[model samples]
Target: MDPLLSLFDPQVDSDSEDIIITETRSATLLSQNGSLPPECEEGNIEYKLKLINPSKTRFEHLVTQMKWRLREGHGEAIYEIGVEDKGLLIGLSQEEVNASLETLYLMADKLGATITILRERIITNDEDNCKARKYTDHRPHKCRKAVEVLVRKVPDDQQTIELRIAVLGNVETGKSTLLGVLTQGETDNGRGSARLNLFRHRHEIQTGRTSSISKEILGFDNKGVPITYNVCRTPEEICEMSSKLLTFIDLGGHQKYLKTTVFGLIAMHGHYAVLVISSIGGVFAGTAREHLGLALALEVPVIVVVNKIDITDNRSLTQTLIQLETLLKSPVCKKIPVRVETEDDVFTYASRLTTDHIIPIFTVSCVSGYGLNLLYKFLYVLPPSVSVNDRQRLIDSKVEFQIDETFQVPEVGLVVSGLLISGLIREGDYLKIGPFDCGLFSPVQVSSLQRHKVASRSVRAAESATLALMSYNNDIDLEKSVRKGMVLIEINDNSYGHKICQYFQARIHVLFHVSMLCPGFQTTIYIGNVRQTAVVVAIMGKKYVSTNESASVMFRFIKQPEYIKNGSRLLFREGPSKGIGHIVQVFPIITKTNDNSL
Candidate 1:
């Protein structure tokens, strides 16, 4: 028997001087020279975790639980390593690793064993590889981006922190009214909201409507929860800003901006989203569909604020709440909280009304200043923390500069103008161009970076930067590689693109119908720079879209093209018409049956 396996045996005497080797089905425990054997160590380190049970858990969950236990000073616990798949692999920091060890001690106690960890000395002769490895662990995952924007760590007791709130919703959904009412004393009637503190102060702040789409710091809590907010208009803007940990994202209420709204909800990855449904507008109409879609897509906690209650007929607030409850109970937003609040003082009174677990609803007249206090209080109570991490979810902080116009500078060969989706990109950063084709070498060093066409020192993620990248002497296919809708990302070590048809499947929401026979027909696709014609081998949907229905369709591309990673904007064009439908699934193919693939 392996020396490590013998230590874990139940029959092994606890007082044995020689290393007691014991084996359980999955894990082998040993106490020899204060370190376990290499294979056993590898087994524990490479253990696949499940989410359902404590024993069977994912890496991130296990690490998190371990950290918590260690912080509480409990050592020695045993966890059954579960299987890992689909973005469940979590890379922990040094601090997190230490915390896990502490928790592992707790596991040891639970399982009646004393365990110790031995550091693996990784000696490397290559300088670049070592640097890349060091940075890679600190940086986002190889494939996805790390969460760049973090909530400024605050003391547990402090309730208020400076927060930047972006007012978002469909057009004419009282978005402007809400902003105007909140900034009545400060903002002019025609002007929109830029920055106004809902918290009372002596003098009003003259905040100009932000001229750019990039996130701007609005204010901070006296204790410093930096409130930086930006209003999103385009899909690029939504994608960029939502990648950060913005305190409050107020979506635009304009119906035309549905795409922006959807992207914001998904990208922001908010733990809690405030869905403002106008009471006068009823529950299920134009903007309601849009809001409902967001509520469905993201299973985050939602607070539905029913605006314009004052304008409604004799129907009491209670009746409207009941109406909202009925709709929210649907799969989209279940157990939504509704509240009817009249106008009151901004600070003292507003914070009192924002409680209620499932869905906190507030009925306020943005025009009449009614229920404004309640909104403030609710905003105050929001959890100021971000989710696991953007990189863990395969989200990258990118800047998609719409090639609005380009020009050549004397010093720099070619200068491209566009908005950064996310991440602060400066000069000399090695950019991965169109997959790993050239191996992340052709560096697009920033000769000059600008915002609103004006030059600036550094450009932040989700902001617009008119950057002048040092062009390669040899003219690469810049047209196809760097064109409209092309994204720029700083490549991480694990950032390898995959061209797989069976990429952990999921149901898709396909729009724009061309032919009924198109269901099972395979066709060519051009996603980013990838051009592959795959067979529309299988369609995974029973319900057909009478008008617009979401279904999962499977395709087997002719030649699997690299750079066509999951969620790489799939543009399916039938025959000559280039793009017929958009591709949303890139993470995993959720459901599948045998014999479906060719």
Candidate 2:
């Protein structure tokens, strides 16, 4: 097999190895005499054009300066790839280099520029270093450390390709269980025993769900390229690592856990998002509807995983598949059924199913370690280049939470437990929390944080984060500062928030048959996982609202919710059921169409 082909195959290598390129170039520019100078002369392109490390900030900075020189009539600067980090750094003419220095100074003030060797030399050594560094070995290359130089040509095309996959679904749908099977290998021993022990013995909580994200790594060879898969626990974690990786994010799918907002569905950012539907349940739940709405908004590619096939009846499985297909008819879902019976069966099924064009199914029990290979193969076979931007704003993004629990520790000072929809807080980071939205808020410090039972240094934008913090102001009112379902963050964006007596807008495709809709009826409004009893003060676009024909509506929340800020989001949880309709707006009834009385 060709060397390049082997690099792209996962079966070949386990780690990324640098691919080398060799090239020779002619000295096109003439000396003062209009002829090629002797090899000893520094003016000769043959001697001056050499490859330097690209990854080094110094190398990239030099290249950028060289481009500016070439643009300013410094003549062509040629180069070749030497070491992977040292691609090629071409030297520019003296006058051009001087001009490039001015542009560099301007960019440094706003976004902090890396301390480049060239910049360091220019700043410290000034004229002498510039003259000497430009010509010979007398002046060292502007670098943090001495660098080896290699004569080489830069490749015309340098492309960095990566894949991002997200897994999202309702709560208790075995989201984390399937993640264990897919990512488990000889190296993984499951979530750290130390963490599990803490929850079981210390917390006294019967059920432990994912609090913060977890991280794992999978390395294999694809063709000849060394393929490294960075596996993360949540969608936000995936984005943080997306800068340079083929990342796969495993999200927790639980209806009650889903924060339901643009911020809540953040884990959905990927080339494609895979929805895990349990065959154990046999039907789409409310959480499924929320996920579908976000998917529709983003117009992303959806792949459905029908997990736990070993326990589900074939008849129920078939029906579930049909229903999912019908609901997601736009791109149509690629279905993969998972059955776990034995460890050996894991890889056997993984390899077979992903090779086919259709969605492949493998039976594996995460507990017993089955069908793991099939999961890996399916992930490795995914196509490249997918974007999710258009439907990103389908629901409101800003939100606050109803504190299900809160307490204070002498070591930490204060610990707040609640759902988050809008603003993000990280460990050791400082935040302002209080009423009046102004000076009332005292800066609070977060230290030693725990999410879902997993202790994390920090937490992202999520409905879950059982936070432990220390506030500077002890006199501050903890109760009044954070109201249940109150606005935790007043988002800067005017377009977000719960609009009362306002039309609640949403995108409802023909796939979703109307189950129930109460116009001008009293129902509880839940925003950012905070449940509050509020009447549906009014409904707009009557013709479209009732027919389920209109895509958006304005819902006037009966009372001005405490924490709900402008552009914040809310969902309708009818009667005793835990979850229900999506809310796009909540505001005062100013229009004549207002029907429901306060």
Candidate 3:
């Protein structure tokens, strides 16, 4: 992590939009203001003085370099033309820039990639204002410009680059409204008119509160244009036209819906968490902070959004920002906060998210659409935190799909929706579903699957989808047998990861609790898509553990056995008490009525 700043940058205390790139490293926003930062030794970002023309050998080498950069970025990279290797912004003339762009186009085309001109800035130079004015010529020219372009090439195996971001904040923080505006290509009416498009239930529409997990996507095509234009009016159209997809897992923000929120966090396979804060109230005294903590504990990268700026007064807005800055600097989060206001801020800060502990703070209003373009551009270029290698490894590993939500559509029959944690699933592939209440696995086949509301023949790891299932034996009721938190795994004669466990041991740290936590303390446990109540049957080598204390504890699922894998991270909570840990050991199956102690 970059060294933490002792305090929030004083320049940010004002109500003016922040233009910070927290890291003083390459491509720092401040450096770009007067001079380009020194070229970075590594990363997908590259600097070029000008590529107007090159020899065949040099062109081939440049193409190879571009290929490496695309791989490093997992499909996308930034090329800063008219910038020198020594951090000088000695821009190029228009003709040179045109030729350079033509060369870039050829380079991208040669590598089967596409290019999008991100932005171009004309650099001004006044000899009269120079320190060496006496030695300067009579005329000053400002025709040169610095251009930034995005080059993208999706890997051969993937159709679209998908990134899931869980939207979390207190109720009325504009989570739903924000998504509605971004996906619907319309601003709110100050009365949250845009939000109406996202509500799934009557109560949500009437009360303006979300009680369930709703999803909406914002997509970008290979040319980096948002697919929300009038022509692409439907999800299917957006999916069909997009090369990159951003799935916003809109979660409930009320305290009562915390479980739903937590489930969404774990089950959605989120690559990042967008913590939306209301500018009027800052981080709500309760749910918002809790959501941020949950995201950090889960190790998910977070981006902050302070919404409703259109309604907030300057004084209050400043105060809220200061508070957030202070809280993020605290030991609990230890995050470097970057304030984003422009397109430059977006690229500089967003490109470095996965490499550092920096968190970019975006202030926007759904009503006025303030600062929204920056946010949209940021999401467009935001890289997935999961590396291509790791995702590929999971896709090749044993098949494991988690069940979080299930539906029974009229013509589709029984449909199960959740994330495919690993491996692949194809239509008609035989798979084992569940460690039913009886603690055993059953055989089932995938009738069909859908991705992004479009029927698809197959699904891959790290992708969320709805799978229609068919059980040939009919020994178990499809509607009654399948439940949330169950597994759908590849059929194996040995039957691994298909059995349930009644008790397991874990190393846990208590986050908060009034009194010492003793054996028999029970709480709701959430691991992946699994949610169940468990009791601490025993504390290893210790009788009691209090707040901030760590201990190895044995837990028994109070209701029924659950399919828990070893080394899986988990979160447990009850009332004001909470803890996070991982399953260190999963014991063999024990019947629900078993009373034998370990």
Candidate 4:
């Protein structure tokens, strides 16, 4: 076993670890110098050409900075000891390296963080000339050796850091099979026996095609090793024992279920997207390309998975990879393809994924379990990309929960499940659910909350959970009143009066269209979890908007009013026509009522 492999890599090491990179324009702060980009003030990645013995005050300041980096990364930080602040890979001497590592470990101990030397790199000066390739670090002559390390400490306020990744690809691309192998501790039998447990519908089981959204969770312990059924008897036990949770939203890949796929991408609020491309079936099948386009339009970062390598011939696999790489490099995607082939590559790319526009592509087989270890290591180290300030704002904002599914449990009353858009919620909290037929909200009490089938003390911002609800005053018929696409929010006032929107304005860019889009054009509109049919009422400064054009358009929902918010991402589509926008303003239809509407 290699010393560089961390506990989560391939084989387990007793040692514990990216300074997490955020997905924002923060990287623009860097200035390119030669080939290395200078370090920025923000983000979890810190570059130190060398960390040697420093004064007492200097060491304290270094510790403080590491603390902030950990917070920004939601408890993870990356320290490149041999890298310069300006991104130069200058290796230090063996004596200097040891001293530098001592300083780093001390700094981590001050903040209760765990540290691990992730991997090492050898840098050679141009002066080394022809012998650079033959030089080794032990010689300590004409060569520089650098080391990369990972620092980790779980946040104090939360037990686990949660991340949502949406799985998308064409039908029969082995999406479910890959997820099943990852979540369950089992390999396939070359007959797709692994994916059978993930099917949600009778037709899907009969046809082996997913037609609805299904969810599977992968848990990792604090040291970053995966926790599966082998370690825990049940998922509830896994949730309790793990420190990081990844929720994979599995969506339908067939064209007939495109709407369902869109709803999951928008409503689930996924932080990352896994675009699966089958090596044998090739890239152009079912809705593979369309799924990629949707993920791009929604601004979700993507990781491409090339599955079914065990069954594909080398020539076919090469051709499929070339085609997939070409599609990724297209103007619309404009993403660089980074192939993950080793443990070192996995650690390097995963730590920088959120900050870079490069997409990590993996080749894996469910039956043989080839390349799965590398993928797991990459995912285990990946952190949530949302910045700290943005997360705080969402937590401080008013509570709003979007309903994606409704169910009737025998023991429990009405059970509504979805993502919590903002604010915090606890059991027994009173919230408002509605904008019903006549446009009014009714009071409802949260009886209990369950996250991943485990009883939750509370659910906070950006977390998904199912809440058991009981009608306040028992006046509303829970089953008849609650449905999908509605919201549950907290009302601070006694005023029963509420308003829903029938009209809204958005700045949109037309991606594709059969013809010019003009007034009275009807399309399916998706914003968060709310899906409705809306007709374009007017286009400002233009009579009609065509493909590749941008405009401000006003739309009115045809069927009913919806509770909406300003600045939400909006997508509209009809047949093959697709356009994306954000709500700039909303026109509310105020519904004044002393009670709930049915």
Give the TM-score of each candidate. Answer: 0.46, 0.43, 0.88, 0.88
CA lDDT of 292 in candidate 3? 83
Q: Residue 373 in candidate 3 has what lDDT?
A: 85
Regarding lDDT, does 2 or 4 come out ahead? 4
lDDT of 4 by residue, 1-598 (tens): 2111121122221212122222322221121221246776888888887778889999999999999888778788888776667766566677877899999999999897888777766565555333433323445355466777788886665667789999999899988889889998789998888888889988988888989999998998767788876678777988888778899999999989999999999999999999998998887666877888788778788999999999989999999887776656544356777788988777867866866788889999999999998998888889777656677789898888999999999989799999998889999998888877667777888999999878887998888999999886466687987788898888563332333688889999887776799999999999988898999999999999987789999999998788887888999878878888899988767656444443
Worst 10 residues of 2 by lDDT: 149-158
lDDT of 3 by residue, 306-380 (tens): 999999799999999987876776554677887897777888888788878888999998888889888989999
| Cα misplacement distance, residue 274 of candidate 3 (Å) | 1.4
Model 4 Cα RMSD, 1 decimal:
9.0
Q: Write down the TM-score for model 2.
A: 0.43
Q: What TM-score number comes out for model 4?
A: 0.88
Clashing pairs in 4: 18-77, 19-77, 19-78
Scored by Cα lDDT, where does model 3 land? 0.81
Sort the candidates on lDDT, descending order.
3, 4, 1, 2
Residue 20 of candidate 4: its Cα lDDT?
Answer: 22
Q: Which tens-of-lDDT digit does each residue in 301-357 have in candidate 1? A: 555677776667657555666666655443323343434342222221222222222
For candidate 3, what is the TM-score? 0.88
Candidate 3 displacement at residue 361 in angstroms: 2.0
List, residue by residue over 1-598, the lDDT tens digit for candidate 2: 2222221122333123332222212222211122222432121022223232234676556555544322221122222111111222224433434344334333332222211211111212234334324443433433211111111111111012244566666655666556544443322233332123222123222454543333332333322122322345543443333322343455445444444332233422356666677766743564555565455345455556666666667787777765554433322222233332333233233223323322333444454454555555445434333111211221134333234445656665557765454445556765544322221234556666664345666443332456765656656656345543322333232322223233344322112223434445455555443444554433444443332233444444444333343444334444322222444433433422222111
